[model samples]
Target chain A: CTSPCAAPFERRRPGFLTLGCRGVSTGARGDPHSEGKARRAGRIAVCGKACLAKEVFGETLNESRDPDRPPERYTSRYYLRFAFLEQAWDRLAEAGFHMVACHSGCAAALLGEPSDDRTWNSYIEYVFFRS
Target chain B: CTSPCAAPFERRRPGFLTLGCRGVSTGARGDPHSEGKARRAGRIAVCGKACLAKEVFGETLNESRDPDRPPERYTSRYYLRFAFLEQAWDRLAEAGFHMVACHSGCAAALLGEPSDDRTWNSYIEYVFFRS
Candidate 1:
């Protein structure tokens, strides 16, 4: 069990790194396990995006019951990790898009200032994260 | 004769790339050539920095008279180009430095902006170029 499992979160656990779980229900409070079980009982079949669905059930017993194995590359663990990394890289790249001109004129200043300043300091920051 | 020599000036000539000559004598006016001669006859040897001095007359007939080549790297053409490139790179890098935290927090934001904005528009611009 991950250390997070012991520290019962009060305010509905805010999202953090989740790829480690392959979207499998950890049976933790606020986890999707109970909802999934209830939905199944009601026969209200719920389908999710393929990637998300894989994320949700890829680690459970049902995953092993299937005779065919998902490609190792498409395994929930690998896919989730890749998704996480790709999201981070995309965000970083988006933040970078804010200053196309500045990087061209002044080299030293751009390279020397702190990193967060460029993304969070100006209208550009708002543009990158919010808009 | 330089291409610029053919272009007649109405208002005072704006500065351009000028480190092609040594600080000896180019015989070109508004170029410190006549200034150097007039000052010499008038007993006012307007002194300049060694580096700047090397820049002015480094290409004229006088340069041939001197045996020293002033390290091949320090020649006007070389130094001026180097200085220009260094200054350009410094400015670009400085523009880059403005987003230090951004670069760290979001790798893409800082790298994508143009070269002038980081140094020209933001308060950081005043901080870098003006201050």
Candidate 2:
């Protein structure tokens, strides 16, 4: 990885990003830590189209600044405070991520679609234990 | 496409469901609507574990019930209200999803790992536009 892309945790810019994470708790191959660790932490720069940004960060925007008129305010901007996953995943993988359990969109991003078809690309532990 | 599974935007459960969405907006083929319309919307049931659920729905739980004691209270629960994406993706695909943008976790799920390499299993539009 390069400068900013490499050190995703330290990389920050004045732009939009849509983020999320993934973790592999079982059957992972790379690092031992990743085998049982939560495997994500970081960010990604997005072009931030208005509607897209709004859709992505609408609720968070409301919670942070204006709970009353969040959607309207979010609509006013061209960016969003996305969930911190993309960057996290990148950084973890660079460091070494084992078998990541892709959560939410992260899971979908891995599995192609959310079905029981083995044809899917993503594979997460069907059973997770409480640690 | 199954009964309740096929009829998404309707399947509702009684507990935790972390939610999120993703859209392709490019290179998709199977369904015209999916190619353009946002590529995610639905819920998946997690076998809620306290620490996991807390990490997942901490913020949302706080925002909804107690901002001050959100994390603390979340720790009390064995599950969290997850984003509604897994169910949505499963429903959409059985219904027919084309090239999807697997936002957030959905993206990670599709992409194997979040690095710029061809070895990845997931593929999404790197460049999405204002629609």
Candidate 3:
């Protein structure tokens, strides 16, 4: 439809902006007409703590009709885009995560998967560096 | 004083948000107490083309007093953060650019320069792939 049917994202905080479909599936990934569960949690785990990164628009990940196996098998990725905090770059980098930005000002690099046909949300990878 | 004097940003387009001072200068880079040109244009060049990527709040880049040198020497970088366009991921990759994103979702990876101390703008590299 209209790329997740509407605004297709969440505005968590002042500078926090998540663009495109709610989860990875809603855009072209999860065609609304499909009859069953499309994908599972594109979750986030940092410092051994896991959190729900995807915004459930109409259906939550658990509300779907499939038994959960693992989030890794859920190939269709999701994105959570926001400005970084102090010490965030080094912290994320030290944990095997990568970042990019301009030279002098704040903000460097976008984060996520390598490359795919999907072209709405930003990229993300659930890499538990410390664990 | 309050990090670039105030709200420290410009809302160009409804989803297109530039979060931080007018240029890289107004922030911690160029404290208001300092009375001179701090940095030159941290501009943009894409597809062998360049455009006005910065917004001038009060003093335009040219309005400064210093004789201009190459923009590269003007470290204290600036940022422009927005969602990418269709075919952008592959196109960016083909241009020696790298991206990351979620697996099954539409959004994948961010783009820009490697890790640095700056924290407002998204990372960028003037890597001209074709040329």
Among the numbered candidates, top lDDT falls to 2
Chain A TM-score of each candidate structure, as shown: 0.15, 0.21, 0.18
Candidate 2: segments with Cα more than 4 A from true spot:
A1-35, A43-48, A59-131, B1-131
Task: List where candidate 3 sits over 4 angstroms from the true fold.
Answer: A1-86, A99-102, A105-131, B1-45, B49-91, B94-125, B128-131
Give per-residue CA lDDT, model 2, range B1-131, as digits (tens). 44332343355211222222222222334454543333322222222212233333344332332224332122221212455444333433343332122223222212122231111122221111000
**Candidate number with greatest TM-score:** 2
DockQ of each: 0.02, 0.07, 0.04
lDDT per residue as tens, model 1, A1-131: 33322332322222211221111111112221121100000111112122322333244223333335432222322222222212222332332222122111111123334432332121111111111
TM-scores of all predicted structures? 0.12, 0.21, 0.20
Residue range with the least summed lDDT across 10 consecutive positions in model 3 chain B = B11-20
lDDT of 2 at B108: 23
Give the least accurate 10-residue stretch of model 2 chain B, judged by summed lDDT: B122-131
lDDT over C-alpha atoms for residue A117 of model 1: 32
Model 3: per-residue lDDT, tens digit, B10-98? 32111121212212211122121222111212432222111111222122223122234232223223322222221222233332333
Task: List TM-scores of chain B, every candidate.
Answer: 0.15, 0.20, 0.17
Model 1 stretches with alpha carbons more than 4 Å out: A1-80, A83-87, A92-128, B1-92, B95-97, B100-131
lDDT, each prediction: 0.22, 0.27, 0.24
What CAPRI class is candidate 3? Answer: incorrect
Worst 10 residues of 1 chain A by lDDT: A37-46
